[model samples]
Target: MRMIFIGPPGSGKGTQAQLLSQRLGLLHFATGDILRDAVAKDTPEGQRAKPFMTGGQLVPDIIVNDIVNARLRSKNRPVKFIMDGYPRTLAQANSFDAVLKEQGLDLDAVVFLNVGDEEIVRRNGARWTCINPECKATYNTLTRPPLTPGRCDLCQHLLYQREDDDPATIRRRLQYFHEQAAGILDHYARQGRLIEVPGRGDIEAIYASIVKALGK
Candidate 1:
């Protein structure tokens, strides 16, 4: 039941992936989490990724590809996984297929969470995050504000709006996502494996649609 989850930021696809993974007993491979773990572990690849990360620059595809491939080939890898926040570009998607091929694995589905740009911007504008490095809890200004404004409810750490969550940056990111997503979507669509799910309204409702789409 290998699957890839694709969506713009604030689409709630990550939450859906977690739910689906738990229900199906599939490994949840979130690329950001994996990369952050590697960095925290200070592995060789992590050391290489640190400079780019500290500078707020995107890690090169080669490094990301290597990390993903290593994880997929690890003995601890589950027979099935739901990949999130990966294959951001057409090149990465193509390289990913090669990695799976080498491992005798194939993707069963590519789930695209479809959220409109306006909604994405609106949702992101309400986003906030913990400023403390040790406590990175996220909150939304509109939907899920912390008990105290600008404070993490759990750790009492100061909370802030991520620069990327600004309306301008959100628009920029959405544009980039759509541009890259087209080719990636076409790649899976041609394979008859792409599943588009409406990503609006209630979270459970969105997830229900995903389950139906996957016929699971």
Candidate 2:
């Protein structure tokens, strides 16, 4: 199935998207990962994106759209895809739909992983990531811990708290999330293709519900 997964940061949508893609043989499309890769590679587009990204500003729509369009055209793209962390605005949704139309593909479902803002803040605040530029494995202070505290098991890199994981940033993120995404969710709902799924349970339980939702 061609799908989109929408949820606040730390709502476990990435894990869900990854698992769902594997389970259904869909390509996984993650905008954050793509943007990071582009910036690291310093491609012409990435050069254009770097200043804005490092400044903690949104990359312009044209740059993001171009990167996404390029990735979608890669050979071996799955007939189906599970998209996450993208189309965060109605404008983006329109831009994305137009691109897909040109490619002759249509989205099948938009999954809304509904988790409370309080839970979202808690989840993110508790998260840690490896600081080594070469390794960035993530862990949650409560849910998952490395064998050694504050260290990456694979690379022995020190784990660091992200600046963006602080309460202030989390609050800012939530405000933007509701402001930009609520209407897009409503738009999808109006089309009879939106599925609201609770995201506050065990992974398997959540995946099971997703399967039932998709009826596959």
lDDT of candidates 1 onward, in order = 0.89, 0.85
Q: In candidate 2, where is summed lDDT lowest over 10 consecutive residues?
A: 70-79
TM-score of each: 0.82, 0.77
Tens digits of lDDT, candidate 2, 4-74: 89988777888999999898898888888889899999887788889999998998878888877777766
Tell me the tens digit of each residue's lDDT in model 1 across 86-134.
8888888988999899989978999999999999988888889999898
**Alpha carbon lDDT at 177, candidate 2:** 89
In model 2, the runs with Cα more than 4 Å from the true position are 74-76, 122-168
- Residue-pair clash count for candidate 2: 0
